[model samples]
Target: MPETSGVPALAVEAPGMEPHPAMKRRAALGLALGALATPALAQAPWPNRPIRLIAPDAPGNGNDITARLLAPQFEAMLGQPMVVDNRPGAGGRIGVEAAWRAAPDGYTFLIGNAGSNGINAAIYKDLPYDLVTGFRPISMLVAGPNVLVVNRSTFPVSDVASLVTMLKARGDGYAYGSGGVGSSAHMSMELFRQRAGFVALHIPYRGTPALAQGLITGDAPVAIVNLVNVMPFIRRGEIAALAVTSLTRWPELPEVPTLDESDYPGFETMAWNGLLAPLGTPEPIVARMHETVQKIATNPMIADRVKLLGGQLVASTPDEFAARIAADVAKWRDVAQRGDIRAE
Candidate 1:
């Protein structure tokens, strides 16, 4: 053996065995890192990017205004930009679904109306999303009253009592227009008719503006809209408001009697605006949004603007909002069944 080394030749190792000490240390470190990474990912901060608030109606509608009014405040509070996305269609289903299907990461939300939030469940034969389950109730920023308006010439009814008398006399001769078949306007009138114990023909239109136009042109003699829409016309003598559908008379239209106090003692209906987020959004983010909405609604300048526009500040808690939705749903369910109103 020519100068064999002092060390003996080593035996070949098996294919698989314990890794070498240094290699094993590295492998063990990777496993430990992976274990640590999982919880870290779970605990990450919310709203990594801009937050989206979807408005189901068109841009100028009340819900859209509510979202836009609070967007800047939320951006400052949450340290992120708030974007409003208007997805108007199907009496607000498109936007409601947009919010419903958004990622539950607390970044996507909805500013919905009474139609989308309360009456849709009862009126629509089938709905793409469940309001009770698919949404997390955040806050109700504003509550607005819907007023009954009529063409100055047609039908000749001045107040709830007069309207009820006219309906009793004319039966189904008078007609009313609404944004759609399942809209809050439709349901509110339906509820009114049920309470008054009479029936009238309902004409559905593409939007509130179209319905309002129908009233102005005498295409439909009667219609209901937010007091804001009818106020200018009322001032111009184009339309006459019969009554408000809120429990209390609106300050701007204090002379107009509430439907509840006028003819139907318990008659009150409204189309409220509120904020909601997709289900499973972080609670902290929801709380932050609620606070921002309340702050904006209660601001003296904003409150004055809203009052002038015929809207009241709701600023209710999440629990109160949930209760209101439930109460509205129950009330409309009965109205739908009793009025024999169905999806068209």
Candidate 2:
């Protein structure tokens, strides 16, 4: 009666008709919990979907091969599919630019190599992206010897010395075929000729397939090419592996000596592949991928396949790969300048 206060007090509190104060508090807590859970359910982990690996070449090319080799292992470790996206053109510039432009999300990556990233950096002028700074160096996948090869039945060469002797005698009369003017194949031949003190007329072709055809048909008798490219023909007794350009002998071709051990001591070159991501990828993702690749780099199945296909497994860390890229660029720059090698 003191203050009925126009507010219905006891009459509004019908038994079980209104929620208790404690119950009200509990109800509010439930709403808050649901709001929090919604976000957690909406956002999954970094690799919620298939991760894409862009290979800067055709399906059968080196970068593509490296990507496929990594895919299964990546899937096993990451619990997500790793798909290779082949984007082949413009000496790898097109594919590289694609990777560069991709978002810095952990899902996008590139399968780069000594030629696509290293040699192209040194040779191509005014590139759209910075090769070294624009990418996060992951690790080197595999590296193998670039061998000096000749048509077995057509050329009178068996070893490094014999090839050199033949090259010196033939002089400019000897013609060699390379994929193109500034291709690694062409650079390898130029390096070989300069170091061995000989000259061979260069016959540029559309690509390695054409170059291989030229070698087989005796259109060009000698070529410095990757051992893996001509592996099948070598086994068929059509092409002979004279000397490898790596510092050490390739395991599959153990009988063949390295250029560093032959008369061209200190001579070394290799076809290398590595993984890279767009700059600004999270550190945790980078570390995770590096650790996974390191663990599986020595997988027997991958090792056996690489060996049989003529490759060497190189599981180098990010720092090592970065240093190698820098050094490789410098080496190729010197080679290009000395040999007048430039991309048209």
Candidate 3:
């Protein structure tokens, strides 16, 4: 260590001059310090300061909720505050690009969701970034099923079978509402309709709360929406939950039959969120964070809270999450094409 120059400062050497002994030590320290200051402009180990986790949606949306749920667990494990930065706009392109543009240090990560990481890749003609290649998949943090809901005052259907019967009988005459055309909710309902051999008018609302309100006010006769968005309405009997889209029944709504059990076998869809690192993030940090997330998912308190939010903890391997994202993109692409659904 150089005592005269207390900070890590570089010592420039002339071509013909041999530097003094003190200059040599300071130069060695400075070069090492320069190497260590790649991301945060500091010469400490990874994450000596707070970490930023980007959630690519407006506050209170699905991504935001999941961000809050996992941030504390990350903080506990990493010995730093994991802050949630919401950069919502342009159908999530804003936040995604924001995260992608960040340095690939251990200090920044993204809460990548189905929309930003799945459907957008499928539906958009040209996206600014690539989900498969632009970011490093860390782990799938949580997965939640969308509920098939019908307004109590407007719809007479009580169960999936009855709903299927009416829709099949009416053919493509029914109407359904969702958050937006390319949203997870919209594609989920489209998947259900395809399996049930029916189609409907898709009325797009601005957001989840608006869509839920639309469902209750008879804006659309039936809608498949996020469980978290409509739980209060369902509790008040404003709407009926015909089925959930998980493979098995959701623990939170045990009475609600799964679409798989409702005769659409193997029917499963989730509004999933996962962790992602910038493309060039160090592999050691990615591995350590991946292991940390697996522990967080299995923690009893975190597990209970996820269940309470109507989500299942799925800390999938990086390869597995990447594969799942690819599968989702392909499935949504087919749905969008077959249904002639266009982004708005």
Candidate 4:
């Protein structure tokens, strides 16, 4: 039988065989319906399901806290659940790798920060994903300066100058604690050490809380930690604030001079967290996420909460965030190289 594009050649019917008018009409209607449905299927609305946001740090850490705080607002704006997944390990590389490997269909994103996105990119030579090429910046949620704090009981210094003198006097005999090897805490302290020409052993802990515990218990004499995590202790007089790692003093710790004013001119380092999607995520989705986050950042309640945590709300544009990421990577790359810093 001759073929009729799978219609079976009318079964080799009599030489003049023709499809019945009723059957032809039905076939034409079916074709027309299929054609109409094609565009509808292609244009289905995005985020028809819950979005999985990967926080590349331990629970209660800066990144995880930021993700949890913003998730509700995100869900409200996107009309979908925002599920935060904490996959902490390998100095945040584990979670970041997981996010990078996920499908770029707008359902999976990362709560990237200074540690995972900036310092790690510079120090982790064998990272499974590239910070610049493997992800797209959505928006920067918040930025805060790291505070240089010391154990109130054990640390002899009371200010930046005295701390510098003590560190230089002790050489590598004294040590400082950090959240992790490639963490912002570590890099910030290394930068300060380099500027002050001091040598001190680096003690790496599991997370920010552990680092703070070490300081409180006097196991670690010094540390440069995120302002949010250490602010409460500073207020309680458990940890003494020596200086902030920003060009200018932080509003919350106005009396604590910045490193720039403490002899290290122009010194600055901030710990920031932001949203990022896999590199190939659609631009429309990226734009929508950015705009939604900006709205959340500007909300009175959210803004006030962020301020209480010693952070400044920064709903930066995608381009601006991208540029900041690039600059941070470059700046920390130099610091890491100079300090011979590497993840433990």
Candidate 5:
């Protein structure tokens, strides 16, 4: 053995010991780096096949419309098609539960809104999945503004103020229809009743289509529906648009005024739809898909289509989307409790 300066040399006969200190240190470092890379490499590539996007509502609903409009752009960006799966029923619970149970791969996702994500949490006594913790928010596709519409022949009121006056005079027996109990329309009208100081009966249907039919046939004289769902009827002069349920008027409906402007200062009620993946999905994949969705939202063609549907294209960051969902859940839960709203 030789002592060289501050270091000592190892004997060549030493057992289970490397004689080259530099080489030994390099080998150990290399092994550690390799071990770190293995798991990163083992994770499967995202969009390896068509991604499944579930919309709990049936076809023709806003969620379905949003998923379809963004699918083409997502396919182009992700290099795989987005297969829209509509699992309608149970007040939008079927699709949400399906998505919640899916493998936490980024390939499966859900397009959910206040009805399924926020309102359901507020009204449902037993929820199978937790909205805030069970899934990862991807991005908010749009903020859906609803229109307060009434059949032309049944309701003579023109604007929100007049409608309020009519409801007051008509007493509490008047009926208003919605997609279902605890839905945005149902909740918004409850807010309307609170703010306008009127009492109107609520009628919940299985879906919005039936609600729309009720409006058309005068089975239900008044209803609040997404601008997109009710725009065609409004244009046809079948119903009168009292006010939009947003802070500002939608660009597509420039002539229309928002609820805030309709004598109910600061009034706003908008349903939002966003993409979400099951919990435990890789963060990178979520980020990638979010970026793709942002692009789709901003695409000119997509923007045009959304406008026609009376929806604004807003692709918010995942963190912002998640925060909005959390805030809305809390906000609407309070509204539901105050109004004593429950599912029928």
Candidate 6:
């Protein structure tokens, strides 16, 4: 059998510990009895107990909602109850740390996204876990673009080009809202600001809802928010989407042009969610979980639900997910450095 770092292999006796003649006889009998019991123990299957999935964001947020949507499918496929534990705080650092510290067993997993896994990795200097080494990628579940929306009553700009012209004219006089300092929303807008040669004051809010409220109340006339969270308001005519951050247009907002298509070429940033296990989890368990999740993510029924929630299904392989995470970490690290972004 293969040896894991922390798990000990079954052994009849310790090395260099010889027994006396009488003791040796008893030990032989014990060994024979133990050998008889080993097969049944080894045959026990994985996931005999409930599994825990940690979502490092508040409930109703994209990550949390994704976790809830997939939990039942995972439970049915794995024959174990999958529980979502919400640990929302410190810009997703709290739950990510908790998941990292968990034992390298299949029972515990994390549902993390660009904020927790990508942006935070760039901004947090003394993070407890290494984003690339502390966790094993399971699969990339979904991806959603960010929309640049302005208050219909407050901002006069109509499209990406006009919005850039206005921001350049106004300079730092105009402000924008984001979920937090190091969130994807903040970084996306910062990327835009850097490329467009414009500046806008950043107003940090506690959550996406608060950021949306800031835009609606004209506290911050503009915001780059997740498409899922802001689409409803745009439909209601309370806000107008000027552009999407992805290289291609979002299907939900087909009328809005992409930043790459409008003026800035090759601009593509998105909020994504994926599954990960503590580093050193057994390979067999990881493979099984990945297969199960991929199936669930690709199902037509699940795809329909994801579309309704304004997410595009990715269902990427473990290696693909790992590569994407690395690229995103590097991308955001550069953005944070150039923007001097730090956690509040």
Q: Enumerate clash totals for all models, in the order shown.
A: 0, 0, 0, 0, 0, 0
Q: Candidate 6: minimum summed lDDT over ten consecutive residues — where?
A: 3-12
- Give the TM-score (vs. native) of candidate 6: 0.88
lDDT of 4 by residue, 1-344 (tens): 45455332222246777878876776777677767877999778988999999998778778888888889999999999999999988888899999999999999999999988988888888987778767899889989999999997777677788877777777456889997788888899888888888888999987788898899999987999999988988999988998898888788888989888888898889989989999899999998898898789779998888899999888999989999899999999999999887765
- Model 3 lDDT per residue over 1-344, tens place: 46465455555677998888987897788877666667555445766799999999998988999899889888988899999999998788889999989999888999989888988987787787887788999999988889999987766878888877777787557789888879989999998888788868888889888898888888887988888788878888999999998888888888999999889998888888899999999998999999999899779988888777778898899999999888988888898898887775
Model 4 clashing-pair count:
0
Kindly report which residue stretches of model 5 are placed more than 4 angstroms away from their true locations once superposed: 1-40
Query: What would the per-residue lDDT of candidate 6 be over residues 1-344, giving only the tens digit for each residue?
Result: 67563323344557887656776676677677767787988768999999999999888888899999999999999999999999999889999999999999899999999989988888899998889877999999889898889987777778888777777888456899898899888999888888888878999898888999999999988888888888789999899998898888788889999888887898888889999999999999999998897788778998888888778777789999999899999999999899998775
| Candidates ranked, most accurate by lDDT first | 6, 4, 3, 2, 5, 1
Residue 267 lDDT, candidate 6, scale 0-100:
88
Task: Please identify model 6 stretches exceeding 4 Å from their true place.
Answer: 1-39
Best by lDDT: 6
Q: Give the TM-score of candidate 2.
A: 0.85
Error of 6 at 305 (Å): 1.7
The whole-model lDDT of each prediction reads 0.81, 0.84, 0.86, 0.87, 0.84, 0.88
TM-score of 3: 0.85
Per-residue lDDT tens digits for candidate 5, residues 224-305, read: 8878778888888888888888898777778889988878898877888899999999889998987788777768887887
RMSD of each: 6.8, 7.2, 5.2, 3.8, 6.0, 6.4
User: Which residue pairs clash within candidate 2?
Assistant: none
- Which sections of candidate 3 miss by over 4 Å? 1-44
**TM-score of each prediction:** 0.85, 0.85, 0.85, 0.88, 0.87, 0.88
